[model samples]
Target: MMSYQKFARDVGFIGIVQILTSLSSFFLLPIITKTLGAYDYGLWAQINITVSLISSLALMGLSMSFVRFLSSETDQNKIQEAVYSILFFVTVSGFLASFILYIFAEPLATFGFKDPEATYFVQAGSLLILVSVVESISLFYFRIFRQIEKYSYFTFFETFGKLLIILILLKMGYGLIGVIAATLIVQGIIFLITLIIIISQIGFIIPRFTYIREYLQFSLPLTPNSLIRWVTESSDRYMVTYFLGLGSVGVYSAACSVGNLIQFFVSPLQLILFPELSKLFDHNKMDEVRIYMSHSLRYFLIIAIPAVFGLSALAKPLLSVLTTQDFISGWFVIPIIALAGLMAGIFQIFVNTMFLIKETKPATYINIVAAVTNVLLNLILIPIPSIGILGAAFSTLVSYCLMAAFCVHISLKHFKLDFYYLDIAKSILSSMAMYFFVSSFTISGILELFEAAGVGTIVYLIAMFLIGGFTDHEVSLMKKYLFRSKVNPSTK
Candidate 1:
């Protein structure tokens, strides 16, 4: 308990950062959708999806290598070696990835995006992959070192900075390309700043590539895992573009950007969880790992379950208000996508078991199964006139559900943690009550949507308290984490 007290505080702080990050994304969504409308907004979505897929492939799982290998290290020299070796290697690799994407941008825009004229935007957006890989590695350095303040500040800075710049560029009539330029500019600045801060803290060294082999060996299996996971998570947009059109992809992606917000409940927390769990697992503290994973899952469900319910209840009005009337038809997809986000979070927590034990193949194989299922389902479902884009949403939900089930089965074989099912039941019940209360009102605009949500939040909390949803230990920890208070456990 005492050991992870600092870890708890770190989690609390990162939690705030995630909230801000989500809000920034929410704000960005409307600014782009309303400005660019459906067709061009859909093109923007395609560009982002392409960048994400390419960048993840470029990373080669080095970020995870950084976390696993350096999380427990104390020597600054070895840390420097691992960090620079991975960074420099990724620099070369990232350049190659971006180069390929750049050269192929014409064909991609023509065939993949179904937009022949988007070639220039695709070429310009290729730089995003380079900056994304490097920026992610730099941020992971702060994360592995537990520099929570710097980490949180950078996360906030990049998010809001892009928001401000994109707003300005769009206002000045820059359109989709403006958004891309703004992203590249902000991310490049972030990479440079993080690099300077890193070198300042630890004097620079020419990377010796000593640990490169070991790192690659551990990370290579996971590299393909990223590509496969992309299939399950992002390939559906491409499928929609194929079966429908850029305009429909625009409608699908707008709703997706909202539905996927459910993953925010877990992403920031995972940044801390993976590193801290690595430190403990290296020390043979299996029990502590179990406690950390269990509590993390329990609390994630508490917040995420309510989020899924509230978003489903508000999906229609929320879309109509945030985007235009053209996007309202995509609203039903939000709840399906939100439920998928919920399952994906559960899968992420469970899959850590394989990571801890250094068994990567199983996770890779499971993702392959899920990915194939997703693609096949998209082929069958998306082209149907009756299902259309809703088929895409349902397919994603099914894939994520399958992945979560597979992970839970495999994770338990190695190390099973308490899932706190009864508490999960209580959460479901409380969220159901909030759902009913929220759905009673017809929300038209942003203020009313927020008001209903705020009221629903209070109602959920009150219901949780009434139902004894949290343990005394959990309650005390929440208070201390919230207020940053130092209270003696013996007194409690």
Candidate 2:
């Protein structure tokens, strides 16, 4: 049995790793935006959206298949074959996907981005798709077997390495091309390192492709689900680009980026939650699943609720500090997008039930509704001169809310778990207090922003403690973690 204390500790450690990874992006934001200005920054954002879309398509959802199919496998030969099979398959598919993107770059640049000169950038960015596909597969090997430290360290190293390299390239005046090229180069370097480690541990074997059929059968339906999810999450940028142009989309993307930090609160939980849940479910451990889900949801809400509040409270100042004056106009969208991020996180936690049970259709239907709702809303709302880019943020919020509601309702039918409404209420109250306290700060720059953020975090933790928001078990577990005690998780 995997004790709750161990699980919580892993989540906590991954949370710290996520914070550091996010900080790299935080630092990169100013470097890229300040150097490229709004128009070119918007172009870079567009390139990223394209990469995310195509990469998902190319992988064909095999990443999730790996988690579902191989999370509990112990045989070295079995793991080796499954790992290499997926890697080789995606290598071909990833390359083909990259080639297609390279071929279509001209038309995509002219129509989708409305910048013919962006053709070269789009072509260069195609490599990011190939790297993303294979690296994700390589990294998922660590995740499936619960090797959290290696996973976290590699993620952090890749993120900061990209930041440092990209900053240098941009300083050398390489511009948007430098940003994309630096990312590709860093990801390639990291992938090679990861591959070497994987081979050394498992020993090389030419995959016979024995498991590919079963993996694809289970994973293929997830492809459209991913597509629809992307529509809900990212298609808005395309719409915003079409109606408002690159500068407006750039401002919107900047605000969306800040607001989207709320989602990071859940990444740690999501990263560790699904695989753990899969293993427990496979072993017929229903009670463990419930306990894990309940605790995971509670942890996610407590952290994420405060984050949405803090980001909303600090939106304008945060944006102003991280971006130039040109990007400040979209500050209002930050709170909206932050709330959307919270909804997305909720959807992520609950939707795991669908994945665990192999009920992909319900998840697919839910995303379809969200994607349609998002598209219709964006089409109707964004073109209005008064609404403009705010419409995109609003669409994201509504779509995510719908997806969360639908997933939670369906998930409850499949299995009941503790929702802990009172704890959530306590969390919201604590977040509100943090919001008021943080709002009182007069932030003027990055240093002031970090100071306010630090103090705001302290205030929130203090308020939660004063209200007895944390359970005794949680308190003891943290004590063990902080004091570096050798915790027997079961005893705790």
Candidate 3:
């Protein structure tokens, strides 16, 4: 019985949490960049990419399946069945993966970093895979249950705590090792905290193996999708590191991080939208599902379009202030990566259509195509002296565009959203307007960047309003949600 207003409010709250999380990371980037320098930072990036790749593989997509299966279930026993089943499987897989990574640490370091000295970091990073799986599944439980406030608290604490620990370790002269250790310690701590909270809420249960086969059937198809997504999103860093150098990887990663700010805008919607849509689709509420899908895309574009534009226009100054001159070349890659982020966001929306219908094979197929395309293009382009990291950035943008187009086409056969072409056009035009105004300013430092951003945002909003980017009804709805008292719907 979640009302539209309540949903909006939840999205807003989660959006704030996302903003804080992004900001915390944003703030930490400079510290790490300045402290570790490009080569070490690049190594750190590769380590993280490895962690994500292995962790995703080990989870076998069970985290997503948990949300899919458990979100609408009322049977407490069945809920426990889903929860404990996923936890047990993921825990065993996680530790096994961690052990393998630890045992193969040297070769992995040599392969990924071209430096055997990185073996210690690789061994330390192996621990992250185990703890992170638990953390992820626990958070997924919070999300499926719609305990957004508790979710937000844990998310913020983990993010902020990691930053604080990393900073202190760096100050203590732990250097690159400090960063890796911080990640492991912080994730392990948060994993324990979240585990306690979940157990307290749901109590403990020895999971029956009854649902294991069913869960595996639902989740197994998505394993390739997860791996391929890793390739699309992260394998490029490995390529960059291999082709150019860790310094180049570091520079590319900086731009990618900045561009990833687009996620803060879209991810909150994606997070809330999936479970909501799953429940709606489960109940045969196709009309509501369609409305949610259409509005989700439109609303995402309304913010993301301008963000991509503004960030692209201000990339030079922003990078100059945030990172050292060594990483400033990365500014060139920001616009391409930012647009890729937008495409990634759209891809998430379309893929939800696949998730809702339980036809996940298409998602795996689409990702395979995109991931292969990205790898081939990166190999072909990154070696060309003229392209280098720009090739990686362009490869990302092209692959995501391909994925989005393919997903949209496939999703239409099952459930076609209005696509909202005109509204999207408005968003693009408004963003362009914002870009022109923002780029006109001569920016040198943080203050000027802030000033230009403020002025650009104001101009974008005024232009959007004049160009009918938002309807009166939509604006009224926003006002009602933001200014009015909370509207509590009857429990579902």
Which ranges of candidate 3 are over 4 A from the true structure?
A: 477-492
Candidate 2 lDDT over residue span 1-492, tens digit each: 567768877888889999998888889899889999999999989999999999999999999999999888889988889999999999999999999999999999999999999999999999899999999999998888888999999999998999999999998989888988899998998899999999999999999998999999989999998789999999999999999999998999988888998888898899889999999999999988988998888888988899999999999998899999999999999999999999999999999999999989999999999999999999999999999998999999999999999999999997898989988999999999999999999989889999999999989988888898988666666567677766566645
Per-candidate Cα lDDT values, in order, are 0.91, 0.91, 0.88
Q: Can you write out model 1's per-residue Cα lDDT over 101-167, one digit (the tens) per residue?
A: 9999999999999888999999999999999999999999999998989999999999999999999
Query: What ranking of all candidate models by TM-score puts the best one first?
Result: 2, 1, 3
Candidate 2 regions exceeding 4 Å error are 477-491
**Candidate 3 TM-score, C-alpha based:** 0.95
